[model samples]
Target: MQTPSFYFSRICNALKLAALVCLFLGTSPTWLHAQKSLSNELRAASEQFLATLSSEQKALANLPFDSEWRYDWNYTPRQRKGLPLKQMNEVQRKAAMHLMKAALSNQGVAKAEAIIGLEYVLREVEKRPENDTYRDPENYAFAVFGTPDAQQPWGFSVEGHHLSLHFTVVDNKVEFLPSFFGSNPGIVLPGYVQEGKQVLKEEADIAFRLLGSFDEQQLKKIVLSEKAPNDMLTTNTRKVSLEKREGLSFGEMTSAQQKLFQELLTVYLNKYHVTLKNQELARLRQADMNKIYFAWMGDREPNRGAGRGHYFRVHGPTFLIEYDNTQNGANHVHSVVRDLTNDWGEDLLKAHYEAAHKK
Candidate 1:
């Protein structure tokens, strides 16, 4: 029987020929048409959600464009500073969800909902009280920053336990970064709701498959250490900068390995709305893929029931993707994607401020 890599290699060879022809002819990918109007869609959704908020709720849900809270995000199960679903009426909560639907793709929406629902699983596993608000799914908070305008700069965030998502828009372009999604009891054990399920299964499995195909020399280049980090190296930091770059470069990979890496990245990128995904995908296609690096630590193989302590990161010039499963006997997972230059719309805001100062 042929290995998974064999199939990937064949597929990649076909894509390479088509990609070369497109590049030579200066033609764009078909996804160009998919970028119809993410900015307008987001503005409409934000407006609708805000309209449902009562005056008191608006007081908490709305803030200035430059508010410090715009960047204050966390994925821990703690009291957050936004209008939570628990405080919103059914109509308001539905609107809030609509806003999320506008920002995330179908896959992303499912993951977001699943991550929220995991709180119930946690409540049962931890044996919390019926009235306990600590693990409440409704604890996720939603907030909009500045006014929603088609041409103006503004942002929004929905953050809570195991999830922190942020979106910034300037003119008609949207920037989403520092996005996080996590799972406790990463694999749902028997007797719980959604038993024997893993929301982030693809993330680990795809990576493991790629690792498994590597030879001893390839493993030495990628695996940094035998012990994994306790959490993401850049956990919720206001600003992140990695002084040292480590791991195996994409140029070093075989054709099949490169295809696997691209597939792994698509799993993360596909979480966003198509417009955003296409926009980013276009940038990636034009980027120097050889600069991208893949690094791993801890177990070479995945141990399912109670996971093995493992971590991996895809670091490149433009972005960083990190995944760690070291807590809860390695059954808890923390994964995040951070934009190197534009977390919290750093580049966009900078340009806006410069243009403002000129006038």
Candidate 2:
């Protein structure tokens, strides 16, 4: 029997072959329509954003594609390397937002904005000092990797407290992984600016509804433990590794249960542009559903006691989705979607390098 490594090697080889073919094809119509459409749009937006920045701001915003900094991603509150929104003038900030809007779907754009807005909510709730730098919405940083071009490899990242969005475009294919969205006070109460707003409402509610539908045996198979981890197992790690695959398989679930699970998956997958989302959906459909596992930890009830530690994750051959609400008295939330084989466009970059060296 072929080992997992063998299968992974096969996939990589196939991707390399596809990359070579694409390189020689001089831009296929399907590629142009599906991948280049968004790539070109984002490239144009990125150029416009750079155009508005001064030399120093441009220096701060641009980085080499292969820079180690490209892989340095975090959603924690800290000093990061990029042009923060606070430093941008009104025109520059608008251009920066336009670049961001070009990459996300309407729903995704809303969630990102809401996550940034939550900084204000945190300021009021925590009653921090006036000079508290961490709670400012404009603290988010934007950095571009390489020069944006349709035929070459390039990418960008928009990261800040509670959010990290990375995009890589190569030849017309785009890879989005290691994308994160987090919220403190996951569910804003009636008193905040956006009262009763839950940025990740569907992510939480849909999982709970699916868990509620599970029978005793199903729950026994799915619930890995009663205590949740303080944060995701892969928390900001460059390479993700899950210690075990323990959970109820998708094949074991009822048809309705499976449907609900798929819907939950869509909440994360749909955050990308339509073309990328559809491509990922196609890959998911083709994957071995029996290998997909849904595991839950901590209290099953929602909005229960403070810091009760509720967490769950969906793991499969290609993707990992982790949701944790175990910090800040169980009011904080952190969720991430990672492509097992392609985070930071690793696979595509490999293929591009090989194609470039081919005699």
Candidate 3:
């Protein structure tokens, strides 16, 4: 009997083949367009997560930040240092923390661990004799918006440098968009940096692993440039543009190669609650998956120091995930998970709230 891993292996190989074929024929992976729909389990898992938020925590989902400002005080950031996860005596904090722990896949856990590593970096940086900077409270704070109770649509932001997760839950359902994760000093300076490693090696390696699978022709479209893009799209914007798909398409790939596309899709969407993940999966299926893109530029490798300039962006229908490691050996890293149609639970929560309004 073939184990699940065996099946996964089969699927993975099939996708690799299909993805390559599309490139050879000048076609993109078309299966990217097909949607088998999210399983009930996925939806249920997401809902279960939402059911856990406390009223206080929901109020802090996300305060509107200025589009022009990158590190505005309005939005939570690691440098500002706001809500301490340890200080939460309220139910909201417990619920949010719980939901986050429960909702994330193994990969998500890995990412979260990477984020925690950053917090430690700041701490270690403060302890250094040469450094004058000390960690501030705002460097790692959580803000609540709306009530956290199931009755009230609410959310919380677990934020720090290059690591912000804005998750909104309404009526026992989940909506996580504009979720972000980042790392600066992907590695510490080669010297005097033993305590703090770049902290973003995993993310870079995993992304490149999938990207490396591509053949020569696929590499051209996927590698937009040697430089990484500025920011992950959809994270800071309302409506986004998909005009970048001119040369990229999945329809050209063989059926098996298309599976690789699916794997890529899985890597990002799986970061949130199952319900929201399902929605994202659905959106990806409906959008021109064949038109999705994987763009790169700048340093193809990572290092201990923040690189001078480097960036990369993956943009496609209902899909936009960007990463920039231009700071240290392309060190400074920024990656965001966005929902083009709805960010901050704008679409679903507002509608759900309106429909249930007593008025």
Candidate 4:
């Protein structure tokens, strides 16, 4: 059995050959014609971003696709591998943001920007100094792995405090996985920069609605623990797994309950472009929906204190979604969507490799 990375390398070589063949034949390959329109748009944005960078900045922003750092992703307040937004000039920053926008829906972009803006709210809440290390919205970094070419395998990442978005493209196929979004002061009450603004409001509210619909007997199966965990169980791990599958199965839910659960799932899935989102939805529809589970932990009621400790997770055969508001007195929010077998494009790479090798 060969590793996925090994197949990834072989796929790159095969794609390079395919590119040459297409050029020689004066015709586009089927894969090229079949490429997602969004992938092409994103590649153009990525190239535009690179064009705006100085040599030094470009060096910092680009890295080998196979570098160990490719998997070194996290949603924490710390230094990262790519160029931080603060270091980019206004033009460059705009270019970088364009690349980001290319990968997200309009609503997703709004939510991401709102999450970044919350750093200021956190600074005010903590009363930190001007040079506060953990509260700068511009602290986010952007990095590209491999060259941004439509015919080859490459990827990009935007990561920083409370947000980590990754995209991998190969032969025009895009993989959006290991994506994270978080918020401090999850719900903004009065007196903040944006009063009554909740960055992840839909995520929390829908879960609440779904849980509320559960009867006492159903609740018994869904509430996995008396206490909510302080953070997501799969935080920043290269490989993620849950110790147990304890929750109410999708098969147990009423039709209305199932609809609500799916609506909640759509909130997360909608983070990507429609092309990619549709592809993901198609794969999800093919899965064993009856095997999916929904689990909640911690207090169901609203918290009046400085923070509320609430957590919930939706687990399916191929995907896992985790949302937690147990940190910072429950004022902070962390949520992640992971494709169990496809994070970092493992499945895509594998299939591409096998197909290319077979040919």
lDDT of each: 0.86, 0.86, 0.54, 0.85
Q: Please give the ranking of all candidate structures by lDDT, highest first, separated by commas.
A: 1, 2, 4, 3
* Backbone clashes, candidate 3: 74
TM-score of each: 0.90, 0.90, 0.64, 0.88
| Tens-digit lDDT track of model 4 for 30-138 | 4344346767888899999999999999999999988888899988888988999999999999999999998898989999999988888888877887678789988
Which residue runs does candidate 1 get wrong by more than 4 Å? 1-36, 305-307
- Model 2 scores a TM of 0.90
RMSD of 1: 5.8
Give candidate 4's whole-model lDDT.
0.85
The superposed Cα distance between candidate 4 and the true structure at residue 310, in angstroms, equals 1.2
lDDT agreement of model 2 with the native: 0.86
Distance from true location, Cα of 31 in model 3, Å:
23
- Tens digits of per-residue lDDT, candidate 3, 119-211, equal 446555547432323333224555544434545665555665566666566555455667776664466554344445645565565666656
Q: How much is 305 displaced in model 4, in angstroms?
A: 4.7
- For model 1, the run of ten residues with the poorest summed lDDT: 24-33
Q: How well does candidate 3 match the true structure in TM-score terms? A: 0.64
Sliding window of 10 residues with minimal summed lDDT for model 4 = 23-32
